[model samples]
Structures are given as C-alpha cells and as structure tokens.
Target chain A: MDSTCRRMRAEILDISFSSGHGHIPTCFSVVECLYAAYEVMRHDPKRPDWAERDRFVLSKGHAALGYYAVLAQHSYFDIKEVAGFGAYNSRFGCHADRTKLPGVEASTGSLGHGIGIAVGMALGERVAGRQTKVFTLIGDGESNEGSVWEAVMVANNVGLNNLTIIYDHNKSQGRCLPVTNPGERFRSFGCEVVEVNGHNVDALKEVFARPATGVRAVIADTVKGYGCKTLVDNVNEWHRKSPDAEQLAKLLEELHAPAI
Target chain B: MRRQFKETTTALAATDPRVAVVLGDVSVYMFMDFHRANPGKFYNMGICENSLISVAAGMTATGMRPFVHTIAPFLTERSLEQIKLDCAYNQWPVNIVTCGASFDYAWDGATHHCYTDLAILRLLPNMEVLQPGSRREVDALMRATYDSGKPTYIRLSDHPHDVETNLEFGKGTVLREGKSGVTVMTAGPILPNVMAACEDLDVNLVYFHTLKPMDRALVERFRHDRILVVHDAFGLQEAINEVPGLRTWYHGLPDQFCAWYGTVHDIRARIGLDAPGIRKAVTTLLETPSA
Candidate 1:
C-alpha cells in the first residue's frame, strides 16, 4: 500500500478505536474503494458544493470513518476534526451528517436511501446542464432493501449515464447470511454491470474512468476487514466492535508498519 | 380545489425552471400534461413514499425547488420520518402537496384515510402545514410556498369550500364578526359545514388556511376567553395549546385509524365532523358561559 492510503487507514483505526463507536469492519473493507473513488471522481475539497463538482454519497453510512478519512486527507477540513470522531459535540456522528460536514452530500445512515438520493442528484445535475458524475458506495447487504431496487428502476429508466455505483461485495452479510450474486440482479435492472477485485485500487479507478454507457454498477469483490488480519478472520464480530486501547495499538503498529 | 392545485403547479413550472414535481405514483391524471411539457423536471418515484420524499430532498441540493405530490395518507403518514429527518431537519424548501384528506377516500378504507397529517407535521421543527378550504386559497398558498424558503405541506380535499377566503399564509381571515362571548374557528374543506352549522349563532367566524404559523394572536385573543375549533384532522388540540388559558371545544378525528367504511358524509357524521354534528356541539357550547 502507498503511504497516503496507509496513513488514512491508520487515522480511521485510531478514530474508531478511540471513539468506541464506528462500523470498523465495514470501514476497513471500503478503504481501497474510497482511495480509488477519489482518484477518478471530480471534487475540490475547498469548494465541496461547487456547482460542477462530482457528488459522492456514502449510502452504507456506518462506515463513515473511512469516508471521513479520505476527506481529511484531501484537506476539506483540518485533520484535527478526525480526533473528535463520535464525540458528543463532534461533527462526525456515528453515521454521516451532511450538516456537520461540508463535503458529505446526503445525511445517510439509513440503508436503501443513498442510491435514490444519488440518482436524484444525477437527475438534478442533468437538468442543470452539468456533466458532473454521481458516485455512491453501497454495501452488499444494503442491496436487499426494496428501495434500492426502486432506485435501480428509476436510474435505468432515466438513463442516468452520469451515475455509477460501486457495490462493496464482501460476500458475507451478518455472519448468519450471505449475499447472492448482485451482477445478475443489477443486469436484470438494465444496468451495465462490471465485476472487479475491490482491493485493487487501480482496477477500481479504471472502471469509473470508462465512459458510462448507462447507470453502471461495479460489483467490487472485497473482504469485510481487508487489510487487518485481526478483523478479517472474525468479520462478523468486528463489524461493529471497535478495538480497545491495547488491541488498537498493536493492530495499528502492524497495519502502519506496511508488511501486510 | 385539487384541479386548481394541478393548474397552478403545471402553469408555474412552465415559467420557473426551479420548480420540479416529484410523485409517489399518485395523481397521474393531474400531471399528464406536466410530464410531456417538462419530462426532465417530472419524477415519478414509484410507490415507495419514503424513497420518494428523500429523493425530493436530494433534488433540492442541486438548486431545484421540488414539489412532491401524492395521496395525503401515503405522503404524510407513511413516509413521515423522511419528511421530518430528510426535509425538515435540513430545512430543505420542498413543497409536499397532498390530495384526499379526512374522508375524501373514506370508502377506500382506513389505509387511504389521512386524519393525522396536520398533527404529525405541526410537530416538526421547520415545517409549515396548510389545509386550504377553497380553490383561491390553494392558488394563494402555492404562490406563497414558492417563496417561503422552508419545508411546507399543503393538504387538499375533493370537497370544495366557499367562505370568502383571503389566505395570507400565516394569518386567518375573519368571515364574520360577533360579540366577544363566542368565536368559531375552522380550517380546510370542513369550513363550509362549520359555516352552515353556526348560521343562527351570534359568534365570530375565523377561517385559517395556514395551520402551523396560524394566526396565533387571533387564537390567543378570541380563544383565550372562549372558542370552538373545527379542524379536519388531529391537529386542533395542539394548535389550541399555543395559548395556555382557554375554555376550548375541539372538533377533530380521533387518534386511532378509521376502521369504518362509508361515504365521506357517512363517516364524517359518524365521527361528529358533519354539519349536524358541528351545529349540535356549537349550540350546546354557546349556551354555557365562559369559565
């Protein structure tokens, strides 16, 4: 991993561990997706709401730390704001709050609402005569929601070629269940579905860079805790469990030391 | 009144690019012309009311002022959390226009009946709830809604009302002035029934088109001493609570769902919301002195 991605991951680890309030497994899984998304998606940290800037909404919002880390690294706000993650008086809520963060597009912690919100933005951007693309990161588990399907129809019907969704296809859903193949469903909805290895940042960036023929869904095959050995081996347990101080320090040293 | 809403909205959207209509798969007849004229601006968001509302909120982010249309029950009650969290919480100026209030779809059963929209919406922080009584009130309210710059809900009824309306958004119009002893205030399509019920009485008649920023001063003054409030939905009691002291008589639907299936008048009469019912309640109350 590069130094910038490593540093962002370390910051996510520290904030989640310190706050004792974050979707750690979910956050770790999408580090590469976020790393790659910002690479291809157009955005200026200084002008978050610039009329022509591409908009990204974290539909699976419990993993807000992962998104927040990227925003911090991009200099949207001081890195110090990350230290207060999940605090009583902090802007960083357990779920993403748009009012609290400038770059955060929609206040989405609820499952199934993000893609619809993104499609709305795509619709709005189209009507306004802007070429800004809309990107959304949705969990594989979130695809089960009926509203997600509802949004899929709208996107395909409207031919939202400006919108792209990268599904964090981590296979396992809540330990008890597993996710079915998403490509078939997305393809059935008339979306141009593409399968890719989510951990490969270069591959993730390549798919988004292509000319979107229609509403595209990139099904990213990922592990729940991709980088850290501790969380990945026990993905369900670590999904909501933030590491304690000693566990966090040992994991951070291993992750930051770059032997993974 | 619903036809007035349809005409005003479609006409306004032609001239104003900022105006957009979002639907949860209701009111297709009213919006057929709108869809053809402005296809990009019209969004038929299917039957998912929750997604419909949140999508409308998202549209507002990109410099579009959205007007969401649907059946009153589904728009306000089914997806109420989205209205409060997505729209009102962020103070997005989206207009939620609802059709079929009270017993408008009474025979369609309990699911189609919406009697709690006013009460539920009135509790939200930045929401202004309005149930206009006539076509003119609908026209005036729609004009004001475009510029209000806050989340607003416009509840309309199939039944029409004519009470000489002058609907200034937050203020009420005095239809009849009487001695200080009695004041009868009502809102929405039920105003006509209230008007007929109070014909023989020497009481003040005040009509409110806007429910949230209600004429609080008028209510505090007239209702503080003695007043009778007639509202189509469950919000009358809460609207009266704004001014503490009062000998108040409220006529509204009960909190429970309407389980009975009947015509609009049958259900309204059964629930004591019809002309005879209002007259009986008003006459009995008028006989008593102010506490």
Candidate 2:
C-alpha cells in the first residue's frame, strides 16, 4: 500500500474508534480511487464552486469517511474537523450533504441516485457548450439497484463522452446479489471499459488522465479492506464495527507493517 | 395545457438560454417545432422515468432550467425517491411537468391513472406542487416560477376547465359568492364541473392552482362556513386541511382503483366527479342539518 493511503487508513481507524460511527471496510476499499479522482480532476480545493471545475459524485455514499479523508488530504478541509463526523449538528454526517460539506457536489446516501445526478451534470455541460467532465464512483453492491443500470443506459444513450463512472468492484455483495462481470456489462451498455487494480493510485491516475470516445467506465477491482490484514481477513466482522483502543492499535500496526 | 407548456417553455428558452426540455417520449410530436428551433435544448430521453428526474436535477445543478415532462404516474410515482432526494432534498431547481393527470390515460388501465402524485409530493420539504386548471393558468404559472430556483412540480391535464381564474401562484380565487353559508372548494380541471354543479345552488365557490403554499389565508377566510373540497384528485382536500379550525370533506377517489378502461370524463362520471354527480354531493351537503 502507498504510505499516504496507509496513513489515511490509520486516520479512518482513529476516527471510527473515537466517534463509534463508520463502515470501515467500505471506507478502506475506495481510498485510492477517491485519491486518484482528486489528483486528476480539474478542481481547486480553494474554489470548489469554480464554474469551470470538473465534478465528481460519490454514488456509493457509505464510504463517505474515505471521501472526507481524501478531500482533507487534498486540502478541501482539515482532517481534524472530520473527528466530529456523524455527531449532532456536525457538518459531516454519516452520508455527505453537498450544502454542508465543501468538496461534495451531490448529497447521496440512497444508492443508485448519485450516478443519475452525475449524468445530468455531464449532459448539462454538453448543452452549455462547456468542457467540464463529470465523474461518479459506485460500489459493486450499489449496482444491484435498478436505477444504477437505468442511469448507465441513459448516459450511454445520451452519448455523454464527458461522463466517467468508477465502478468499485470490491465484491462486498458476496453474500447478497453480486454484480459479476461488470466490465462486460458496461461494454454491453456501450461504455468504453477499463480494468485496473483499484489500490494502485498510479494505474488509476493513468486511467483517469486518458481521454475517451464515449461514456467511460473504469472497473476498479479492489479488496473490501485494503490496508489492515486483520480487517481484510475478517471483512464482515469489521464492516461497520468501530474499534476499541486495543483493536485500533492492532489495526494501525497492521496498516503500517512492511509488505512482502 | 401541454401546448401551453410547450409555448411558455419555448418562449422562455429563446431568451433565457438555460431552459432545456427533457421528455419521456410522451409528447414528442407536440414539441417538434421546439426541437427544431432549439437543437440541443430538447431531448426525447426515452422511458427511464427515474433517470429523467435525476438527469433533470443534474441539468439544474449545471445552471440550466430543466423540465422533465412525461406521463403523470410514471414520472411522479415510479420515480418518487429521485424527486425527493436528487431534487427536493438536494435543493435542485428542476421543473417537473407531467401529463396524464388522474385518468388522462384511463383507457390504458389503472397503471396509467395517478391521483396520489400531488398528495404525496406536497409532503416533501422545499417542493412546489401546482395543478393549473387552464391554459392561461399554465402559461402564467410557468412564467412566474420556472426560474425561481426551487424544485417545482406542475401537473398538466388534458382536460382543462376553461375558466378564468385569479392567476396568482399561491392564492385561491373566489369565483362566486353566495348568501348560503356553504363554500364549495375545488382545484384543476374539475372546476368546470364544480362550477356547473353549483350553478343553481346557493353556494360560494373557491378554486386553487397551487397545492403547496396553499392559499392558507384564503382558506382561513372561509373557516366559519363548511368547506366542501370537491375535486377529481386527493391533494386539494389534504391541502385545504392544512388550515386549522375548518370542517372539510373530500369528494374524490375511493380506496380502490378505477379498474375499468374509459376516457377521463367517463372515469370521472363513474366516480361521481362529473357535473351532475358533483351537484348531487353538494346538494346533499347543503341540505344536511348543521351540527
């Protein structure tokens, strides 16, 4: 794992332990994907509402903790402020609200909604004759929603070359309905599909930098828990579980351990 | 009313440049001139109702005024969550202009019928619900609030009442004032029937185009009298009840579906919303002894 992502994982564990609120594994799954997005997107952290800036929506909003950490790393806000996440009257809720948060473009919690809104943003840019690109990240689990497919079909039919969908194929829906062969599915829907190891920020950034012919779908194959071995091994157990003091120390140690 | 919608929206698009129309393949032919005049401003975005709303909300976020037009039931009911979350909750200013109000597509069966749209949508925060009863009202209301930067749902009907109304956004008009103390309240296309029903009877008539931000002050003015909410749908009665200290009864849809296939007028007549049927209900209310 990248040292910065490892540090972000440690931060996630710390916040989860303190606030007792987080989907830890899901948050871990998209760290690099979110990081690569911010690195490649044409956004000024200081001017989030710059009319010419590119837009990104976190369709699978369960991983808002990861999103906040990445936004903080990019200087949208201080990571220290995120400790108050999910607390009463806190700007950062369990799911992000666009009005409250600085970097969030759309407030998305209900699965299958953010992608559709992202489609509109891209199409709206085309209508206005602007060069703004719109990106959205959706989970393999969220792909279970019919609205997700509906949005994909609409984006393709509308010929939105400015729209790119980052599909986090983390296989979190191993127990329920898993979206198998997502790259093939997106290809069938007329999207330019790319497969990449999601945790590799370099490969993800390369894919994000490339121009596309039509609506693009980056199938990011990832592990539910990417950094800590304990969380990776016991994914279900650590899915929504906040850590105790001992558990947090163990997770942090595992995250910082040298890889073979 | 759909023609009025196209006319008003077409006019707005000429100058505003932000006005875009997204259709669900329902009234594509009516907007042919519009599609030609403004190339990229209009899209026949297929039958995905949920995506239509989400896309419209997206367009609204991009500084364009978008109108999502389609059949009433599919646009409002099938895609309720999109409207509630993507538009209302997110505070995106998209205009939802739907046709096939109530039994407008009655021949297509119960799947096409929609009476719950206005009632359910009015409950969402930061939503504006309007059922304009005439072409004039449609034109005026669209001009008033199309770019107000609020999520607005305008339910257009094939059966406009053809009556001259107050034309205000939230204020209801007193079409007739009678000595008899009974105030017959109604909304949308049902007003013509309501008008004919109360023509001979000694009763005051009240009409509304806006459902939310409902003319509460006007509703309060008729509080002393028995307010009989007569309409072809569920929302007007619920809206009237928003004002306290008023006695209101709904004369609209029953608990079950109007299962038979017919025209909108046929269904209305069968369900006691036509002129004579409405007159019978009003006369019975007037004859009943006051409590």
Worst 10 residues of 2 chain B by lDDT: B282-291
Q: lDDT at B20 for candidate 2? A: 90
What is the lDDT of every predicted structure here?
0.83, 0.92
lDDT of 2 by residue, B1-291 (tens): 999999999999899899999999989999999999999999999899999999999999999998899999999999999999999999998999999979998999999999999999999999999999999999999998898778999999988878889998988999999877889999898888999999989999999999987999999889989888997888889889978878877788888999789798899899899999999988888899473
Best by DockQ: 2
State residue B138's C-alpha deviation in candidate 2, in Å.
0.6
Cα TM-score per model:
0.95, 0.99
How would you encode candidate 1's per-residue C-alpha lDDT over B53-119 as one tens digit per residue? 7778778878898888889888888888788877887567789999888778888998888888998
Error of 1 at B186 (Å): 1.6
Q: What are the per-model DockQ values? A: 0.60, 0.88
Q: Give the clashing residue pairs of candidate 2, or none.
A: none
- DockQ category of candidate 2: high
